[model samples]
Target chain A: MDIRKLVGGNVARLRKKTGLKQEPFSEAAGISQSYLSQIENGHVNLTLLGVNDLAQALGVPPIELFRELSEMNPD
Target chain B: MDIRKLVGGNVARLRKKTGLKQEPFSEAAGISQSYLSQIENGHVNLTLLGVNDLAQALGVPPIELFRELSEMNPD
Candidate 1:
């Protein structure tokens, strides 16, 4: 269902909401700039590890990312 | 931050909250049972697509997961 697009969009939205740039977010999440960009662009497949890192960096749980994505584009 | 444990716990909680088993959730999310199991146990990584699928199947936004997780385990 084009989940990548949904995830990418959500990441962008959250990053903006928290006033964090890709670099800082990546640093906080312990991810690479390229990987984070890929996620933001729907160009990568995130592992549970990746999402977990993101959750921690964003001060939320991993599921929060998915929940936000769903809210953004509900059925 | 042991994001794995957090994600795994959240997945388990959600599954239980919805009265769903891993098999049904895997089917709904279009993921494999093994993969879903790993996620539930903090043994696998999750892609944006994976999270999106779970969100869609669970009828919630991606961020809601993180929020719930936070509520479950505050800082």
Candidate 2:
């Protein structure tokens, strides 16, 4: 699976677990709501710091942003 | 702890675990040896895809590049 999609899914799932909408959650995340939308949609190649920021806002480990990853065979 | 440093340390350690020098390792990672050096030194804010690429090159899950990450308490 694509890493972006994986991250996006994890973020979305975690955000839902918080029961906060994108708008409020974006505020908590210190990013724009649209950016949060993009993030949930897997449209961003976020910087490492960006990932950390999101993880912090989400109250999860940065690695949680990449939960459920299986080793890929690079082609 | 800084996420970059954590990631850099993980990469550096994993690369060493492979017992390959920077030149060969960089080639496997499909990045310049100098770029690898920067990554290993925590001097780069690599894009999300870049992280995945590095993980693939290292023959590990992309998340392994972020192993040992403890959730940061967003300040």
Provide TM-scores for the models.
0.57, 0.89
Docking class of 2: medium
Model 2, runs deviating above 4 Å: A69-75, B69-75
**Which parts of model 1 are misplaced by more than 4 Å?**
A1-40, A51-75, B68-75
In terms of DockQ, which candidate is strongest? Answer: 2
Q: How well does candidate 2 match the true structure in TM-score terms?
A: 0.89
lDDT of 1 by residue, B1-75 (tens): 465666566677777788988898888778889888888787766655656567667776554444445476689
Q: In DockQ, how does model 2 score against the reference complex? A: 0.78
What is candidate 1's CA lDDT for residue B47? Answer: 59
lDDT of 2 by residue, A1-75 (tens): 788888998899889999999999999888999999999899999989999999999999898888773423344
Model 2 over residues B1-75: C-alpha lDDT tens digits? Answer: 788888998899889999999999998777899999999999999889999988988889888888773433343
